[model samples]
Target: MNIDIYSPDAYTTGIPHEQFKWLRDNDPIHWHAHPEGGGYWVVSRHADVITVSRDFKTFSAEQGFVLVDDLPGDILDMARNQLLGMDPPKHSPLRRAVITRFTSRRLEQLEPAIREIARGMMETARNIGEVNFVESLAGDLPTAVIGSLLDIPRDMWPQMRRWSDLQTSASDPDLGGTPEEVNNASIEMGTYGFQLACERKDSGADDLISLLINQEVEGESVSEAEFASLFVQIAVAGNETTRGLISSGMYELIQRPELYRQLEQNPDLIPGAVEEMLRWTCPLHYFRRTATADAEIAGQAIAQGDKVVMLYSAANFDERVFDNPMEFNIHRDSNPHLAFGHGIHLCLGANLARLEARIFLEEFFREFGGIELTGEPAFIRSNMVHGFKQMPVRLLPR
Candidate 1:
């Protein structure tokens, strides 16, 4: 079957289960032409994606920076500085420097504060009676949490969110801006981050920004440009991906009231429930890696420099790996989902994202007895990011 899987339009109809099912069965490693030009091999099986993710030498994130479409020069340079784009040796040190901040213990300590943030967000929604959960509710948690981490001013959080939204939604005509507009936004955000770093240079603020600014790596302090890139990395990555999780998790629960009610009754199940949500609606559909050399994946020859997309969404539902693959079950044990990715480039903020989701849901169901969809939920028009762009819901306050 000829399928235009790369199109943004395909994602609006939701996960292309039919096409993926065919690929998983007939061609676990399938090649498809890109509409824009060139082509990529889509790796659908869970194990294959894991192999590609782990064997970074063969499939290099640094080679192409993990997006199917070739990015503009500025964006490409920005991506190279991110942990996601850095290859070994370099990737390890940078990721290690920031890893301690997002440990399970640190996230646990932040849970109560996150709970407070959730309550405040819910209170704002309750006062309004009804609000767009995407904007008023789900969107704020990531930005606030990330801003608090980076020492960015609360007033600046909204602008940070705007920049992140634009950066990730480059495919959506309605949401995306011109290359120049995007570049300007990045520069603005980066400049703001630099100023904050300079302020914290000697003031000794106990925050991630300060830690990064004060600490030295490889016996040398990080450069202003490197710091700016790291700043953008934490700000945008933490904001957009987790925001997608919260919004998509809610949309899924509201649609599956049985699952929603189950969670409401047994709040203890939320942690597992959150995992299932991540697996079921893996926010990032796929992340591309370029072949470093001529390689073979599942018998398909991939030429050097060819793009290979690890379809996390498809892999999460791989029939061979997941029992009852399509079903959204909160109790699914041994999930092994790649929502935050895997291997050396695994998400540095994975624990934080999970903590935010768990606390947000716990607080959500505790305060509001029931959540009902008041209007259609809108999906972001992009292949890379998957989640609701607009989710209208009524919170039935307990």
Candidate 2:
């Protein structure tokens, strides 16, 4: 079956459910020729996505950074070392260092601070009856939280958001720039991180960046360049993905007010509601992995070095996995959503993202009795980052 999953046009209408439905029914592991030279296998079924993610030895993230199109050599190298890209032995120790700080105990301690930030954001939105939900409210909250964690100056939060926005919005005509522009932004951010690391190394501040700089990993401290790359990854990844969750979650809730009211009436349902929101509006559409050896997935033969993309958005809505997959149910019980992904390469900041979303929603509804879109919301044009680009909303103060 000739599939055109790589075309940005196919995703313009959103998720391409019809195409995915066809793939799931006829060819769960379908191949499509890439417009940019190589081809990739599109993994549609939930079971296959889980299988591929679990069998990391066969499907390597390090082969190529998780995108349908191959990246430049330098960028590819940087991606290979990121927590999302590393395989086995190298991945373990770096992940361990950061995972320690992201533990449940640490998250619990950070709750009050996160809630305070959420409350403040809502208060600011409450003061202004009408605001761009994506910009005025949802966008900056994640940056502030992540910035605080990394000991980054609050004044630079907007710059961090700008860099992240540019990096992720590859399909938006206004935001998308030439490859040189993107690379320049990466360099600028990395330079900034290196400068910060140097200061932390000399001054010896007790913060996440300081810890990362000083702490030994596998008998040696993380190199300056590695630290810079890691810094960019954390700041950009944390900000973009969490922002998508907040903005997209609110958009979906307002569209399905019955479910929204259920959550508002029963605050206890917020956690499950967040999971359902993630299922319905999965922040990332897909992540790519390259086959390291010849393998058969779901009965389809995949050759070595062939690119494979796990369609998480489609998996979340897989009929076989999620009953009533299309419905936005706040009370969804067995929502085994792939929003945070799965297996060894699962999202490291999943807990923090969930906590941010739950608290943000609670505070939002508490401050505003109702949220309505003042105008038609706009979606980000990228096939990768699936979420709202602009959401003009009115906050009816309680």
Candidate 3:
């Protein structure tokens, strides 16, 4: 079966699992033709994806981070400046300037605040028995947490969520924005971000925004334009993907009542359960890297400047790395899922995302004695983000 996995429509129906397995087994480093222009090598196996993610010299994000189709020149230039799209010698120092804030100790300190936010959300959810879980519950906390961290005023969060939702899922009608609308959102968001950075530039605030504005790279602080890109990255990246973890993770539980029961019986298992959920639902399908030098993977030669896409959702199910890869077992130990990725460009918010998911599950199972799906769950159409746009469910108070 010759399926165009690159097409976002391929994911509109659902994740093509069997096709990914076929690619992994037959052509782990398969070549896929892009309708717009150049072709890219699809790295489907876990080991191969790791190799491409690790060898920064061989593959470069600055060339074009995680995009198979080339973006417009202006958009591409801004993307290259973000931490997610930079190469070494440049990526390392910028990352170091802010890594300390996202460490386990720092995030753990924010647990009480996160739990308070989760508790309040659940309390509100208790009153509305039947609701769209995505809008009502899953979407708010990530924005709240990140907003608090950035010192963005509470009043501005709704708009922040709207911009992020539009930017991340532009292809889905449920979350549609015209190309012009999408571009305008980015411009407006960046402008707002620049304003925030300037306000905090010398205020001595300890939030993430202040750190980025105040901290020096080599000898110079981050430029306003650079911080604008970083701000949008942090705001959107922190919200959408982490919300996917909560929404998609809950969807998995509702379908598997047996697993849900098992988790309810033993709460301590939640940390691992969150890990299993992450492995089972690869939130982001893939991220593209450009080959900076000629390299061969699984005997397939790739030329410099070629696009190499790492298929995370497909690689997570590789039988070679996962035992009974199709089965969902919460007790599955030693899960090395690439949901947060596996390199220096690895998700900076990995710890915070995990903490939020774990705490969310703990609070959810504790608050709702019974919950059931009332309508079909709909996934966002974009292949980049694997998340629910709408999931209707009824909740019963304890």
Candidate 4:
């Protein structure tokens, strides 16, 4: 097969599952050349992805940062501060500090507020009748939830969303700006976060921002600069990925009316359906790691400093792990999808994303009697971010 996964255009219409399947079957550890320079190894099998994720000592997230594209020296320095891009000894303390706030107990306390946000957004969508589900409906809830968590002014939520979009959707003309603009958005966003950390540090406030800026783990506290990078990752990640989950998940349901009604009739089944959504419409396609030492993945010899990318979308459908992996079955007894990734670097907001998705579905079913696509959905033009950019739909009010 002529491999074109490197081009964002390959994913413009939809996921290239055929290519992924071919690669997984024939070359589980296939090496494909990057447009920018040399080649990198692509890990497509579920077990190998897990192996690479678990053995972070040999496959370092910090060496090259998490992105497949190499960043400039200064940008790499900024990215190293993010929890996703840090290795053990240094990764543990910061992760512990942030994990405290996202524990199950904390998420339980947060459920009511997230439900209200989802409820309000759904009601407004019902009132509008026809809307772009991605923007007017799905996107706002994440921004609101994260904004409320950090106590950011409501007025700034849209700006943060824009900045986050620019950073993640840089390959899309409609969604992202030029390279210079993208850099500016990241800088401006980090500056704003730094300002918040400075103001909230030692303030004894109860919001998430205060919790992060003031709390210490292993006798070390988060510096303002550190918090800035953390803030960018948290805010941008929460908004972009969660929005994709809700919107793309809904799009999938809209395609299958029977499943939609099944979910609507039994709202209790929404959690299971959410897991299928994460697997089927996985928000991220891949994340890269650099090898610290020569290693082997599925018998493929990898040299030190080689870039290895775990294809989450492909691994989610690996036949060895998931039965009838292509089918969107919500009743799978054991669905171990790598949508939130695996091992220590798993998504910090995993539970929060689940809570938001479940609540959004429940509230959406409550507020709207039925929903149908009014126009063809258009996906974002990016290889990394797999989601609909615009989904026009009419919501029939309950």
Candidate 5:
């Protein structure tokens, strides 16, 4: 079977796991042709993905990451500045400046508030049965958490969510806006972020925004432009990907009552459950890195400046690394999935996302007795982001 990993339609129908399995078994480092014109290497195995992620010197993220197509110049410039898009030397300082704030001790302090947010949101969701789980609950939790962290006003959370949804789901008509609207969302979000930075400049407020604005990167403060980019990154990622973990997670769990019951009976199982959900659903399919030097991956030759896409979804399901890689086992031992990319660019919001998912599940079981899928869910038409556009489900009252 011919596997076209670059096709958005390939993901819209469902993740081409069969194709991924074939590639892992047959062509571990497969050359995938994009219809746009050229082709790039698809690194399918678990080890190769880690190799590419860790060896930033060889596979550069700054030189345009996406394999399907190159980003437009202005956007590319902005992307290269993002925490995800920068290479080491420059990447470390900015990352270090903010990493301290997300440490486990800090997150532990926020757990109670996060739980309160989760319970409050679940209470509202339980009341509104037969709703789009995406919009009603999953969408709201992370936005509130991230907004609170940034000290963004409560009233603006909805707008922040809108901007996030638009950028990530731009290809999905039902979930996203027009091209003009997408551009406008970015400009408006950045403008809002810039405004916040200016207001908080030396205000001595201790939120993520203030911390970002005040931090010294290579003996220089992070500029408003950079803050705007990081703001959009945090907001979108916190909202979009967390929403995926919660909603997609429920979708999977509801289908397997044993697992659902297991989690409900033993809340301690949540952390493990969250890990499995991340691996099983794998919110994102791939993150692209550019070959800075001609490097060989899994014994395949890659030229300098060539695009190399790490197929995370494929790697997570590789039987070589994961025992019964296709099965969703909450208690699966030694689980090392790359749902969050490995190494330096490993998502900045990884801990926050995990916290949100864990608490969301805990509160969900505490409130609802059962979850019933009321309508067929539709997925976004984007290969890069793997998530639902709409998941209509009824919350069963206890």
Candidate 6:
């Protein structure tokens, strides 16, 4: 089949699974041309993706900064500070420091706050009766959770979500503005975070921002500028991916009523169902890594400095790794989907996202007797973010 994997339009209706399947079967390490000029290698198979993710020395996230399109020099410098775009040694110490805030114990302690947020949103949903799920319900919990963690004012929560949406979904017309506006949003958000870090320094406050600002990562405290980038990473990552997980997961469950009822009846199965949703939704499509040395992946020649992208959406459904890969099975015995990615740069908030999702599902089923699609769900126009931009749904309160 003809393929235009780079085009945002290709993914608007849904994931171009057919093209991905074709690439996986025929050209697992396919070379695709970039819009700017040179091309990049797309790694489709699960094993190959894991291989690239693990061997960071071979494929360096810091080199190209994890996007298909290269950022400008100044922007690239700031992007490198993000945990998503850092190499080891530097990446390790910082990841260790920040990860402490997202540890299982911490997430467990934070569960009540997260549950309260979810329940409140569900209550609002019940009152609304019919509304866009993405805007009204699904986006609130993550935004609020991140806000609470940073001790951001409740009033600024909407602006936080707006900044995150502009940065991550710039390809979506409804959600994003002009390229200049997108760049400005990043700058504004970073500036706000930088100011926060400066204000919180040495204050001995207990919020996540203060903890990060005061604590010594590797015998040195985090600088305000570094914290600015880190803040952008955490806020954007927390907002976009979790929102996608919750909204798209609900959309999937809404489509399968029997499965939905099954999950509602047996809430214990919700966690497993969340896994299925992660596998099915696969929030972010791909993250690019530049090769440090010459390499060969799946017998395909990969020269030094070649852009190699691990296609998570494709790898999650690899025929070798998953049986009946296309089908969504909550009870699938073994699921090692790369939704949060793999290896050293694996998402720091992975467990927290899981906690949020599980609670969101539990509270959702508890608050609403039933939910039906009021209109066809509309996907955001972006190759990177896989989610519903608008899902109009009517809720029946129990």
For model 5 the TM-score comes to 0.96
TM agreement with the true structure for every prediction: 0.96, 0.96, 0.97, 0.99, 0.96, 0.99
Q: How many backbone overlaps does candidate 5 show? A: 0
* Candidate 3 structure, TM-score to reference: 0.97
lDDT by candidate, in order shown: 0.85, 0.85, 0.87, 0.92, 0.86, 0.92
Model 5, 107: alpha-carbon shift in Å? 0.4
lDDT of 2: 0.85
For model 3, the local distance difference test gives 0.87
lDDT of 5 at 375: 82
Candidate 6 lDDT tens digits, 326-370: 898989989999999999989898888899999998998899888
- Candidate 5 worst ten-residue window by lDDT: 65-74
lDDT-wise, the better of 1 and 6 is 6
lDDT of 1 at 310: 94
RMSD of each: 1.5, 1.5, 1.3, 0.8, 1.5, 0.9
Candidate 4's C-alpha runs over 4 A off are: none
Task: Tell me the TM-score of model 4.
Answer: 0.99
Misplaced by over 4 Å in model 1 are none
* Per-residue lDDT of 283 in model 1: 83
Stretches off by above 4 angstroms in model 5 are none
lDDT of 5 by residue, 1-398 (tens): 87877767888866789999999999999988867778889999999999999999998888884434777776777767678888888788878877878999989999998999999988888778788998888888988999899999899988898888787778777767887898788778888988998898888888888988987867888888878777877888888888888888888888899999999999999999899999988888998999888889877999997889999999999898889887888999789998988998899889999998988888888898998998899888988888887899888978
Off by over 4 Å in 3: none
Rate residue 117 of model 1 by lDDT.
85
Considering every candidate listed, which one attains the maximal lDDT? 4
